[model samples]
Target: MQQTVPPPLRPYIIHPYLRRTHTMIKKRIEDDILIVTLENGRDNSITAEFYHELKDIIQEANSKPSPKGIIFTGEGRFFSSGFNLSMFLSFKTPREIADFFSKTEEPVLLDLFMCSKPVIAALNGHTVAGGLILAMACDYRLATPNPKAKYGMSEIKIGLPLAIAQGEIVRFGVADDRNYRDLVYFGKMMDVNEARENRMVDEVVEESELIPRAKQLVSLWIDNPGRAFTPIKRLLRGPLADRIQKGIDELDWEDSLKCFFYDDVRKTLEFVQASLNK
Candidate 1:
């Protein structure tokens, strides 16, 4: 079957955002929202370059004539698979791994949290581990009703502890505490319907309606673009964000770095590489 054309592109003609040519992010301004797409292909793993692109987008979003709101989504089958394992595995020492995690946790993340404009997520498909982190940074999340589409924070399975600070960023959007625990503790990927039942997904619709519905939802928030939304966002999230900051400041990322060198991690990488080849 022929693939559908990508959502229409808009020129950045005079935008202030500085972007690297190798970044996988795509940006377009649609109506009152700045639409940013994660285009890292089927897996859409987050690379250092992805962070650079995201930082540029947020900086531009904060510049003069900044967009009133933002819409973030993914292209193709999956939203994001989280950090690229190839890059993570490149480090030979615990120090290198610590550096990797530090670089991955960029200020752009904080920028997303503090942006005055409301950000919405059009969660197109499977979102796992750090993928959930990206989705959580947005103010709203819309997901497609695919039985195979799963969402979760699966960092623990890889011998790395959950980035609880980032995890809290996503959990706040959820309506129930039980649902939040299920996602963080068990680390199992949950289907679209399950995500909706737990309030992880704001709306669940047919795959065909995903983009249009996302646009519709963002449009609804445009009416009071500068007045109501931003303030409430600050008031509601400010405290939780402070805790996240504290958690990051105290985390022993060094331990995680050491864990990455174990034989199990190496074996896991080999299995993953072999499967990808297939």
Candidate 2:
């Protein structure tokens, strides 16, 4: 006699307010994992709405029970191209730009860095600029071995400086300053093997295996009791976390805003907009 097989598990939408839409960041729960997928166009570029929705989702994930870990990934070919340059170009003044970062971007990234549960980045493809920063904030990173996919910080190339909190996160995340300088100062885009070597990614696998591998990693962490894991993680990450918090607290809005109006930056923004128009 044949035995009955159990039905496969299905994911449920976890965010109460999410309306399934092409551009909305999506949240789903499968077993003990919470999956957050970036879905804001081809590049999955960060927008104001994206930041707000993501922050809400992260908060919700932390408040809920049973999910031992979170997995962050992008919808398609690009993990994320970075901050929304188009949105920045729309800002009328440097103060507005400063306010956007202080209120939205910085806080969201910091939240990820300090999340109570372990977070994993499942990089589906190319990740650049602020996208790289976001991934680095996660506890672990796994990427698809797509030769075409590039990874690096391109802020300097784009005429932007890394904010204080962002700089601290990089310093904490990357094991070597030389690699960090190569990514941030030189703006070099590296392939998967190079990224893994430089400690940007923990592992690289086929595209189809990315999510499964991320789940496997999360399961390994989740097997530990939360009471044991949470405190240890906090202790291990505490010093850097404190520095990040201090930097954010002391962030100089006026000095930070000055870069937004720099002639070179303005030209870069114009060039980006022009390219997008084409």
Candidate 3:
């Protein structure tokens, strides 16, 4: 298949809101596929800056002579440790925390889920909580078969309930009702094989073969033109998308914020922070 080479992308502007120290995302175009790597030091913990950069990059990839697909992966042993816990813990008000999620995280997940081209999350390592939500937003997910690498949502254990959008993404992505309940209710981290068995990940491959397998999957869907592909995806995913959007609209942000104020959550956050510091 002859692939279309997209025109040069407009240089992305570094948003003034982004912290100057956090240039952790890197992008490279490979024959119609955009490979985006997240290497924010050790854990690639997401922050406001990470969200802005990621949103811009994905937007860029969707522009002129749009790439056939996008592959998102992380460097080192952790794909993402989820949200930047330290920063999140610092917010003083419910509104501030609500704004952070509504303004930063929500849009990015929506973009990935509703993207015109196929999006694949190539998990090189551990993926938890918000990281799992991000992976769920993708059309397909692939993970490296490392026994040490874990994947699952741990928000319940941390005294945080799933946001409406987050919950919808998981429900829509993972088809089995039993698997969905187990993941969210228990907040258990599963190994690669277990994740695959529960349909959380499409396939598990060796670290060396992760990107290649992702590219192979992208090739299968790249043939559809954007006009056709976009609408078809909308139609196919419409019911779930509508359900998710409605839930987002009805979510009680103020009440959701109260979770962070609980003693159990604070203790859990403290524990998580201490462990990360080690």
* Best-fitting candidate, scored by TM-score: 3
- Candidate 3 yields a Cα-based lDDT of 0.78
- The predictions' CA RMSDs to the true structure, in order, are 8.3, 8.0, 4.3
TM-score of 3: 0.88
- Per-residue alpha-carbon lDDT of candidate 2 for residues 127-207, written as tens digits (9 for 90 to 100): 988888889989999998799999998888778888876877876778698778777889999998898988889988888
Q: Per-residue lDDT for 5 in model 1?
A: 19
Which is better, 1 or 3, measured by TM-score? Answer: 3
Clashes of 2: 0
Q: Pairs clashing in candidate 2?
A: none
133-211: candidate 3 lDDT, tens digit per residue: 8888888899987998999999887888777778888887785888899899999999998988887898878888999
Instruction: Give candidate 2 regions above 4 Å deviation.
Output: 1-23
User: What lDDT tens digits, residue by residue, belong to model 1 across residues 1-278?
Assistant: 33111121122122112223567778887776788888885778777667666766766665534576788888888898887776656666776656545444534575577666668888988887778888878877899877888888776666665554566777777777787787777878888877877777888877787777777766676565344655566677878877776766677778845767888976676666456445
Cα TM-score per model: 0.83, 0.88, 0.88
Candidate 2, position 182, lDDT: 76
- State which candidate has the highest lDDT: 3
List lDDT for all candidates, in order. Answer: 0.69, 0.76, 0.78
Residue 110 lDDT (model 3): 68
Residue 93's C-alpha lDDT in candidate 2?
Answer: 71
Clash count per candidate: 0, 0, 0
